[model samples]
Target: MRRDIFTDEHEAFRDMVRQFIAREVTPYHEQWERDGVVSRDVWRAAGRAGLLGIDIDEKYGGGGNPDYRYYAVMNEEFARAGATGPMFNVHNDMIGRYLDRLCTPEQRERWLPGYCSGDLIAAIAMTEPGAGSDLQGIRTTATRTGDHYVLNGQKTFISNGQLADIVIVVARTDPAQGHKGISLLVVERDMPGFARGRNLDKIGLHAQDTSELFFTDVRVPGANLLGAEGGGFVALMQNLPRERVTIGVFALAVADKAFEDTLAYVKQRQAFGQPIGSFQHSKFLLAELATELAVARAFTDKAIAAHCDDELSVQEASMVKWWDTELCNRVTDRCVQLHGGYGYMREYPVARAWADSRVQSIFGGTTEIQKEIIGRSLGL
Candidate 1:
């Protein structure tokens, strides 16, 4: 099972990222989990290691490579290593696109340096307290004043919410137009009336900070607007495919790691005076899991290629997102079972992985949403 999507150069970059994580991430991950947030030092280390913005412009302190494979490589390493704390995928794959592709030149000059340097952490506010996947249901509003837009809304379950210096707030500019009224405004830290609620406690991904954000008449300058007014929904639609595909990529990597861990566990754990893996049931299960992962991997690789080529369709992205995420959950659950009593213990990686994998099928558009998108694409 060789992947042709990456070149030798990509492998080299992957090695560098792996080493960086070992040095900068793994040692402090447990402390971070206890702290309920990652240290800003890691973000700065990522910037120094050239891992923050591979696709951003070089003049702004980025790697300047538009190739998306670098991100896939990074995602694979992060998943395989069970590193879920750093919200790099959200930054580089999701928010970075909006800033890199949709921002005005002035905005880039103002933000890209810190963005690429990791001095300014970014997050996009899309999901509201009431609106999950239904963008048309958003009630957040940003009304234009003499020179600024008055923003008032609350965003929940926001990744990197507590640490973000720049939040791209999605709000309605034309309340009468529904989805067409949506717009993106950059709300910087210390903006009057912009407040963050407590970092939420979660079942898993304990190292990653999630929080609720409140904007009470937060005045955002006109220059902070991202893209054209009333164009936020369209912009989101265009960029969501990338986010979905990245989730799928993460799914495959986690599944592969789970399978590998289970395989190792079964071969070592004895049953009836012999390795459990020697049993027909365990052997077949391992074989089946491996085969399933290979099939999904092939499709995910194709999706990544299509995305890099700007040809990945929404339907195809949905298909992979749901399929791989579901597969990750199923495989991880089975892996936990195969670990017997040990899997139930929090000390085991499989136990933690089980908890961490649960959210994949729900976030980045739920599995039901993905299916609906696919169904509609098929003219159902």
Candidate 2:
């Protein structure tokens, strides 16, 4: 299917992202997987290539282009390349918004330059040891002192935790107010008593660093507060739609890649003196998969457009997140079955994609969560 979303400029940007992945991501991905984290050098290279900060202002060393299509292009290319190691989506899509939109002038001057330059790797520490998806359940607390907030909490499954120079931590400021009490604090590296636990051993996405972060009497300066003292929950909700759309787009792109790869595989690998795809079952299956993919692409493209216009709603975003990710999982699973034993091999890109795609539906809010949000909006 021909996607009408991209113009010549978008395609040109896609080419640059493809080249950046080829030069900076692909070669080192294997070693990174073994090392359990990607090198910060690639992050710097991405910054230099104008891939790190597409929406950030140029004065702060960013691309200064707020158009969302450019980000969509980058995510699609990353999915196609099977380069899931970098958390560029997390950095550029989620955390960048808080910095770009809400940061005070002084805060922006202090952080935006390195953030755009990749000198300061950023991560949002929202998921805690006990909290996953339920923001209200977070136990991390930030008690105000005269000049700083004394933070005490533990965050697990933090992407970029080990490498983050700046962490946007979600903590309770006035516990009595529940959600309204929550606030965002900028926790910088090497702040006294701030510590990172070991890089976690995960089932997949090995090159991406996931770890536990500890803050015991960690003094975060009052100036480091991201937004209004208790406006963190609102800020999180505002940016979540973009983050969810990013996941949906990535899911569709990767499913398309898997379909393309599997289609070629079925044509060449002979079974019983004929290409397996020649069989009736294979043809019907592939036909179904192809149709499903096209259907998803159509919806996903529209969601991206709505998101760019800042017109996307909570319900719509949830629908896109649930449907596309579930479809991505379903499509990849079928493609793997079509590959038979070979699909199970770790060496094949399909195998890695299968593993990587699992977390898509799980993270960015679970599919069940998306459905609940949608259901509630409908007066369920």
Candidate 3:
């Protein structure tokens, strides 16, 4: 079914995104996967293409567009291209929101130009070895000194960890206050005692860098503090719905692309001298997947629209996140099954997509965690 949620401008933006991906991302993706990170040059190219900070103020070198549909279009195109290398969604959707919302004028002047231009990449560090979803469980400490906050902590599973020029570090500013004690400090690259561990190998998403970050007595200037000193928890909570929606956008796009590819494959690949898709079982499976995907697309688009309108609730975001990501995993798994033995090969897109889609339900909050949020919203 045709989606009416986007206007001509969005379609035009989608076209430009596709062209940009074709030129900048497609050729280098394989080499990037082998190297465990994308080239920083593509980031610069993305910046040049006006893809980095869509909602940031034009005075700060951004497109000055706050319409979330543009971002949705970009993510959908990237997923369809199977170009997960640059982590643009992380740069644009996740960290950009933080900087846009929390940055002081001086901080914005310092960071936004480079950030929008992709000269300085950004990452947010929240999950630690001891804490994943439970924000209250974090142990990373930040002690206020005369002129700065002394940060001491380790963060794991940080996206853009290896390449980020600036990392928004979440630390305990007041350990005595539990969740209320948390704060966000922007830790720059040359900050003393700040170190990055090896780029960790993952089950998939080889081109995107995820790593461990260490901050030992790293003194962050007080000016780098984001929002209120102990407002990190509330800030994270407010932004999480948008993050989950971003994840859902990618998940649903991947699932849709997988189905599109598999549909063509089943119709062409012969089994016992007949197209496999002609068989009753294969036909039935395709029918079911098609129905599910249509339903998911409708709901996902609705959620996107809600987010644009600033009306998306945490419960609704969680619902879309878990449901779409789980659907992505399911669709990819079945696509591999339809491909039979060929699907097991890493060379096939379906195989790679299957691996990539697995992490969707895990990150952006686990499927179980999302369900828990939904249940709590029901007053259970």
Off by over 4 Å in 3: none
In Å, residue 114's CA in model 2 sits off its true spot by 0.5
Task: List, residue by residue over 1-380, the lDDT tens digit for candidate 2.
Answer: 89898899999988888989989999999999999999999889989998877899999999999999999999999998899989999899888998998999999999999999989999999998789989889999999999999999999999999899999999999999999999999999989989999999987889999999999999999999999999999999998888899999999899999999999999999999999999999999999999999988898899999988889999999988889899889988998999999999979988898988888998878898899999999999
lDDT of 3: 0.94
| Residue pairs whose backbone atoms clash in candidate 3 | none
RMSD of 2: 0.8
Candidate 2 residues lying further than 4 Å off, grouped into runs, are: none
Q: What is candidate 2's local distance difference test score?
A: 0.92
Highest-lDDT candidate? 3
Worst 10 residues of 2 by lDDT: 356-365
Query: Which lDDT values do the candidates have, in the order given?
Result: 0.93, 0.92, 0.94
lDDT of predicted model 1: 0.93
